[model samples]
Target: MKKSLLIGATALALTLASPFSQAHRVWIKPSTTSVSGDSEWITFDVAVANGIFHPDHFAYPAERLSVVSPSGNPVDIQNQQKLRYRSVFDVELTESGTYKVFNASQSLVAFWKDEDGERHFWPGRGKTGTVEEFYQAVPQDADDLNVMETANRLETYVTLGAPTADNNKLTGKGLELKALTHPNDAYTGEPIDFQFFMSGDKAQGTKVIVVKDGEKYRDTAGGVEVTADKEGKISLQFDEPGMYWLEAEYEDDKAKAPAKKRRASYVLVFEVLPL
Candidate 1:
């Protein structure tokens, strides 16, 4: 017996669609962006929801979460649980610096038709499969064969005593965010700069979409869009103090064989404080 498939038809449909246009948003919300104490604890909520910060759809898998300490060390999370609509966890910050909480993943998705002319998908319809499994199960001459590689990251920042840049360094493997302005130091009415990277290089002309919390109460979605400059940087300012969601996506033809394209997406939830 094989394991169940990681993706279903609906999930495959969403994967083929525009990455940024998806209605379901995935995020990790921290109790506080800044804190102080010898040992402070921060609670987090992880969810895939239709509304910002609202966990109405499904809980993001808690097992996929991780925390990086200010010194670039792996920190452990406590009290993790998955409920009906959200996953909750707590992190104990013993170091007096910033922490990076995130969920990052990469996978290959494929579509094809078998000899019988029946449509099929790599990883199949009912169970998960690996690259080797995909190669063995999918015929080399399969009709309409299409394959894509995807990398996605969802992240939030929390500072215990002071912010540190050690843990914010980019891995240079996929799409990533480099904080020119410390994420925990964002303030209302003041501009904060951030740089985007794709496979370690500057992601010039990347489009970044931002939406503040409380979209359910507003008449309009009130989302804002900004494009990265030639330096792969964008500056943002908020009028009111609140939590905001920021996302960026990039697609290219850098994928290896069996995969024609690569799609990378990055998401961050940060707070803006009143001056």
Candidate 2:
């Protein structure tokens, strides 16, 4: 009877945890996508949840939020707020070009036991390392072992003046989605193309999730999946004007070995304007 109860509880835990875990994506949303006047202040909110713009989940801490100016420098924000639903921060639009708001967190610890009774520990952060480097850090006596690392990296951009295709400013290490079409200048009914890169190389076989922000406060998207071509490209078309979030995930199956799995996630938030 005790064994049966234990198994039942475990099943219940997995059932409840699956949806929550799958939805825990981090994203940032600015108050406006493009600014033209003398307005120098922009307010934004940041959150970590399945629903990108929805405030149903937890907000990212202030320390995790940051801004990069148009002149290639980090800028400070004010009116900082944090709540269960979402965290809010305000930035002064000092420059006239495109401004970037970003948040990156450290890798946490994740562990699981496989059918073979082997335990695996991986960093809960976003993509961080090569497959060999990942397993090399694991202890050989990893029978009840732990070997892995996962990290979360998120970014969003706002145009201060005329929109430009300045993709080079957003380039960096790890998994990134480069907008082939100028993000802020996109219009409804137009396809927004993005290129995916893992560790600076076109990452093929990556899975992307695209969802339109809804009014009711839910993370339900039925999830749209798209595959990257040989050159690591994927796109989505907006039928109407509204906000949207895109998330890409890639797993190193060949590197998992006898272990469970190693994967990375990247997220982007953009808006579509009406024609």
Candidate 3:
């Protein structure tokens, strides 16, 4: 019975990661962070870039996209248009409270031949839904057959007006960013605090990369590095108002079965209004 469950889990992981290759990194950025009226339309650009959210890279389709209202109802995005670099869509903000624009993806798997010319593929898990239970379904001592590396990426947006707890809830899946400073309500000078959680626990030592608008690489100017503390928290303070992309990466090469090495990431793109 146990062996059957492990095989089932592995199959599920492969199913989830079958969409894209290993180089895809997904992110979504909204036109505005906050709106004043009860009824307003906001646009978003969703993309999967190879250089870690850079605009120069090609983008994949924005799949399984939805907007969750403050009251917890999911709204479908309408009038989505795909561009060369990103996919753009708009959502009508009917409620006055905060609305979350969330885009999550299945895990992606990649394999490489080892020294003995044997192909290995790591297992993958679903991003938004129950990932822990899936991992627990598989045993640790399983064979390292077809070992591959798996990764998951997620993006979220917050429109501030009404009160909502949707932005801070943790899915307890792969790497996730919980905004402590309220991403929609961020300002230019105030430090934005974010907590990283991996597989339900605090993801300590995760390296966070922040890139301001127009930068192509992570280590360029207007880019900064921050590492998660022991409690899995990182803080960022924007020097001026503009668009910014923040990404956190975590890798565990010694991870047990179901994953050869768990390489995961979380990305959040938001605008900081000038003070």
Best by lDDT: 1
Q: Positional deviation of 24 in candidate 3, in angstroms? A: 6.7
Clashes of each: 5, 13, 7
Q: How many backbone clashes does candidate 3 have?
A: 7
- lDDT, candidate 3, equals 0.67
Global CA lDDT computed for model 1: 0.82
Predicted candidate 2 versus true structure: per-residue lDDT over 17-76, tens digit per residue: 222246466678888888887657878888766454676765666666678777777888
Per-residue lDDT of candidate 1, residues 1-275 (tens digit): 12224344546335323245477888899888999879889999988788887889777777778899988889988999999999999999999889999877666767788878867656532243457866887776778988877677889999998788887888887789999999999999999999999879998877888999898999999988998988899999989999999988887787887788878889999999898
TM-score of every candidate: 0.88, 0.76, 0.74
Name the runs in model 2 displaced over 4 angstroms.
Answer: 1-21, 105-146, 149-151, 167-172, 215-223, 253-262
TM-score of 2: 0.76
> Which regions of candidate 1 fall more than 4 Å away from where they truly are?
1-21, 113-120, 124-131
Off by over 4 Å in 3: 1-25, 50-54, 106-110, 114-151, 160-163, 216-219, 253-258
Clashing pairs in 3: 97-162, 120-147, 121-146, 121-147, 121-148, 122-147, 122-148
If both were scored by TM-score, which would come out higher, candidate 2 or candidate 3? Answer: 2
Best by TM-score: 1
Instruction: Kindly list the per-residue Cα lDDT of model 3 for residues 143-206, writing each as its tens digit.
Output: 4433334446556676647546565688777788877877777788898888898877899998
> RMSD to the native, candidate 2?
6.1
| Candidate 1 vs 3: which has more lDDT | 1
